[model samples]
Target: MRRLMMTMLFLSFAVGAAACGGGAKTTGADAEGKIKITTTIGMIADITEQVGGEHVKVTALMKPGVDPHLYKASQGDVRKLEEAELILYGGLHLEGKMTDIFENMAKQKTTVAVTRDIPESQLLLVDDGSGTHDPHVWFDVKLWTRATETVQEALSKHDAAHAAEYKQNADAYIAKLRELDQYAARQIASIPEGQRVLVTAHDAFGYFGKAYGIKVMGLQGISTASEYGSKDVSTLRDYLVANKIKAVFVESSVPKKSIEAVIQGAAKQGHEVKIGGELFSDAMGPAGTPEGTYIGMVRHNVDTIVKALK
Candidate 1:
C-alpha cells in the first residue's frame, strides 16, 4: 500500500511541473504577440510609432545626433534584428555603412525601404559628376509626407487587422506635414533673395535649398565622415567674402571645430561671419522635445534658418 502511495505522489508532482512549464511558455508567447519593429533613425521610429499606435513596439538603432553614414551595428543590434517582425529603413544609402547588412536581413524578414518609393527626378543628384544619389530626402516636407504614406502601407500589410488605425494616424501626420511645408515657405520668404544663401558645414542641405529656393554652400561634402581639406575651406571663405554672407551655420551632429576654422579664415580675409545656430542635419533632437518628431524637426529647422538668415 505504501509503494502504491509513492507512485501516486510522484505522478502528481510530474503533472504540476508540466503545468508550470506550459504556463511559462504561454507568457513568452503572449509577450511575442505584440508586434516588434526596428527603424534606422529616431525620426523614422517616431513615424512608425504614430502609425503602429499601441499595437506595436518599435526601436531605433541610431541614437539622436549620431551620423548614420558611419554607424556600425553591434552584436546586440543583430539580436534586435533577429527578434523584429518588421524593419524600416531610409533607403538611398542614408545608412551608407549598414546598407548591405540590412539588404541581407530583408531576405528573411519584412524589410521596407521608406525612401525607395520617391522618384529619382525629385531627388537631387550629386553635382560632382559621380552620379551619386542624394540621400537627404527628409529635408523636404512634401517628399517626407509620401515617405510616411509608404510606411503606413507597409504596416498595413504586416497587420491588416489594424489597417484602419494606421491609415487614420498616417492621414493626421500627413496633414501636419503639409502645414509645416506651408510654414517653411512663408518663413523662407522672409529672408531676402541674396540673403537666402545658406553656408553650412556640409552639403547636406542641397535638397532643402532646392525645395525652398535658397542657394546652399557647404565646406564639406555629402558624407561628414570625410575631412574638409584646406582647399575646400579656402573656396568657402572666398565665397563668403565675395557674397558678403553674414551667418555661417554648424550641424549638431558634426564637429564644430571644422566650422570654426571656416569662421577664422573668413575673419582673416576681412569678412565678418558669425556661427548661426546649430542645425539638425543628419539626426533629430532629443527624444522628448518638440524637435524630436519629424514635423516638429522641420519646423524648428525652418524657424532657425529664417531667424538666422533674415
Candidate 2:
C-alpha cells in the first residue's frame, strides 16, 4: 500500500510539472505555420505585413505615439524578439537607445535593418560629427520605397517559398509610394516658389525638403536632445518677418511649446505666423486611422503643408 501511494504521488507531481512547463513562452513558427516576425516600429511592421502577406505574423514593439529615440525594451519585448524568426528595425541608429540590444540579438537570431542596403551617397549626414546617416528615411516617399524593398527582400530570403508573392506585394506597394511622391510634388508646386518653406519644431524634415522641393528650417537639430538656442530662435523670427513666411508646423511626437514660442517671438517682431496643421514626425497615426498607414500619413502631411503654404 505504501509503494502504491508513493507511485501515485509521483504521478501527481509529474502531471503538475508538465502542466507548469507547458506555459513556457515560444516564438517563431507556431503550429499554425506562420513565420513569426517582430519589428521595432510600426512603419517596419506595416511594410513587413504588406509584403509578407499570408506568410508572416508581425508584432511592433513601439506603438503610435511612442518615441523610438528613447524607447527601452521591456522584458516582454525581449521575449517577443527572442521568439521571432526574423526581427526588423530601422537602421542608422533610429532606435538609438536600443542599439546594444539589437547588436546582441543579431548573433543569435536573423535580425535585419530595414535601411541597411540604402547607398551612403543617398543618405543625409548628421553634420554634428556623429558620422551617422539619418534614420528618418520614411519621411520621403521615394526614399521609403527602398525601405519597403529591403523588407520584402528580407522576408523573401527567410521564406523563399513565398518569394514571388512577396515580390508581387512589394511591387504594388512601391507603385502606391510612387503615386504618393508625385502627389507631394504636385501639391508643393502649388505653393508660390518663394513661400515654399517648411518650418517645424525640429529638424526632422531634411529628407522631406530634399525630396519635395521645399526649404526646411527647424528650431532644433536632428536629434531632440540637441539644444534649442535662444539666439537661433530670435534669428528665425527675424527671418520669418523678412521673408513674410505665414505658417509654421508642429510635430505629433514633439512638444508644441517650442513652436508656440517661435510664433510668439514672431508676433513680438510684428510677423503673424499661424500654426499650420500638425505633421507626423517620428511616428505615424493611430491604428485603424487613415494616417496610421504609411501612404496615408505621407498624403496627410503633403496636403497639410500645401494647404498652409500655398
Candidate 3:
C-alpha cells in the first residue's frame, strides 16, 4: 500500500513539473573565486551563510512554508546541484520524497547531510511497529546546535583557507543556540503541567515535546503523506477532552483543515478548544519575519506555545 501511494505521489509531481515549463535552469556563478553552496531549505542556507560568512554564496531550493517532504526539484535545482562546491541538507529523511535525488547527488558532489552526523542514540524513532528515524531534529535546540557544528566542520574542511572564520562563526552560533535552549525551557516551564499539552496538525513536534515537558499530540504521523485515520482523530479528541486542552495549533506548511478537524472533534466531545497561532513546523516564516532564521524560528515557536498554553 505504501509503495503504491509513493509511486502515485511521484507521478503527480512529475506531471506538475512538466506542466510548469519543465524546470528552471540553474544560473552559474558570475564570480570566479566565490564558493557556491546549495542547501535544501532556507534554515540550512542561513546557517551555512553564518559559517561561510562572506566567502561563500548560498542558495536554498525550498522557500518559506514549503514542505520539504512534498518539494519537487526543478531543472534549475538540478543545475544548482551540479554547480555547487558544497551541498547541505537535513538528513533522516526529512526530504522524504527527495531522498533518492539527494542520495544520487552524494556521489557527484561534496554533499553533506547535516543531520546525519548526529549520533543515533540521541535521535527519536517514529516507529508504528515499523521503525523509522524522525527527521525533525531541528525542533530540539541542543540537537540543532550539534547539527550546526557538523555543517561548520564540513564547510571548514572544504574551504581550508577560511577554516578559522568558519569555526569562530560556528562557536558563536552554538552559544546562541544554547541561549535559545535555556529560554525555551524557561518559557515552557511557565505553562501549568496539565495545560502543557501541545496539539498540532502533524507529528513534527515530537522532539519539541521531548525537549521540554509538554505532551505532544498530532493528527498525522511523521510524513505529511501519512493519512489521518479516524482512530487517530478519536484518540486525540479523547485526550483533549480528558485533559481539557484549550488550544491546538496549525502548521504554516500544512493545510489548516486537519487542525480544524481536531478542534471540531474536541467540540463534539463537549470540550472547548481554540486554534492557537499557526506555528512554523516543516517550514520557516517569510524571509523578513522574526521566524525567518533558525534561531528566530525556534524562539517564535517557544513563544507561541508558551503564550497559548500558559
Best by TM-score: 2
lDDT at residue 127 of model 1 (Cα atoms): 66
Task: List model 3 lDDT by residue over 1-310, tens digit each.
Answer: 9999999999999999898878664434436566889999888888888888888898899999899988888898888888887889998888877788888988987888988778999899986866678989998989988889998999889878889999999998888889999999899999999798899989999999999878988899998988987888888888888988899998989999888877888888788999879899988888888899988998889888888988
Tell me the tens digit of each residue's lDDT in model 2 across 1-310. 9999999999999999989895866767976799999998888889888998888888999988777877889999998999999999998988888898889999998899989888889899986897988788888888789999999888888989989999999999899889888988889989999999999988888999998889999998887767887887897888888999999999988889988888999898888999989998888899999999888888889999988988
Ranked by lDDT from best down, the candidates are 2, 3, 1
Q: State model 3's lDDT.
A: 0.87
Model 1's alpha-carbon lDDT is: 0.86
Candidate 1, residues 13-82, lDDT tens digits: the string is 9999988784632211127476788888887898899888888888899888898888899987877877
Clashes of 1: 0
Clashing pairs for predicted structure model 1, backbone only: none
lDDT, residue 172, candidate 2: 94
Q: Pick the candidate with the highest lDDT.
A: 2
**Candidate 1 Cα errors over 4 Å, as ranges:** 1-32
TM-score on alpha carbons, each prediction = 0.89, 0.91, 0.89
Quote the lDDT for 248 in model 2.
97
Give the per-residue Cα lDDT of candidate 1 at 157: 97
